[model samples]
Target: MEQDTLDLAHISLRPFQLSDADDVMVWATDERVTKFCSWEPYTSKHAAVDFILNITTKFLWCRAICIGDRAIGSVSVQSYSGDDKARAKAAEIGYILGSKYWGKGIATKVVKQVVEMAFVDLPDLVRLEALVDVENVGSQRVLEKAGFQREGILRKFLFLKGKSRDMVMFSVLSDEIGA
Candidate 1:
């Protein structure tokens, strides 16, 4: 609903807009950001912007992470409806940041705000889960800093870069809020 920029002092999270497509292109296509991410390198600026515009209107939860006025990363959630558990007011989250910005706590801060927003925006949203590639230790740490717990290792649970990769299932339940 509200993709307006969110300011939490050190970092800000905003909606991914058509205008941000150009800024997004700088990192979205980089191997460091796309390797473990859901999508692959964008072949062109137009293609990148097209994707950003589409993501803006396609889902209930999506955002562009910004530092100052520049787009540095992105985070989003996809709804699951096939199963009772999947559709019980829950969704899976994913994210990536440019390698140039790595080792900073930007991702952690953005994730925390997004998780809080998810719970507030959707009252029944009892849980938010993230499937992190097993080798992505930095990503795992981001989830933990955001208050998500690693439930288990999902063996070959995801396909990445044309191969089956193990993933760590991390989640945060409603009852665990502020715990």
Candidate 2:
């Protein structure tokens, strides 16, 4: 799918631009923001620049979660790699919001929009999943509020920061949405 922008009541989801580096660095470098994330806290703007240039640019579905003119976070739906067509139809969703926006329901709104986009814009998509660190109750609430069902725990699913961690697997199927 082509890169597209989405407008919600309070936020706009748009493609990341070179100018977004500084704003991205604001949260990306914060220890509080990276604590439950898979990657380490970005130590410099250069790292955020590299991420915007390499990773975000490679995915058409990666979006900067913006409030008005500023980007405060990101959301993405990436298809897993596999030769099988069925595998290609399934994608994983991930998101991060700045700590200041944690309890205002922004994540849930962003997630619901992205999930709708996945089913409507990406015709091949059949399933979308999110794996949240088991200890992150806020993120778990966000996923559940967005209509994702907690399937199970993926034991030692990821090596985040410096140690292996368990993740709670959550998913929302196309047919299961709005039902």
Clashes of each: 0, 0
The C-alpha stretches of model 1 lying farther than 4 A from their native spots are 1-10, 82-86
| Clash count (model 1, backbone only) | 0
Instruction: Please provide TM-scores, in order, for all candidate models, with all chains considered together.
Output: 0.88, 0.91
Q: What is the lDDT of residue 45 in candidate 2?
A: 88
Residues forming the 10-long window of minimal summed lDDT in candidate 2:
1-10
Put down candidate 2 lDDT per residue, 45-68, tens digits, no spaces: 899889888988666489999988
Colliding pairs, model 1: none
lDDT of 1 by residue, 62-103 (tens): 888887767788888777755666476778888878777777
- The residue pairs in collision within model 2 are none
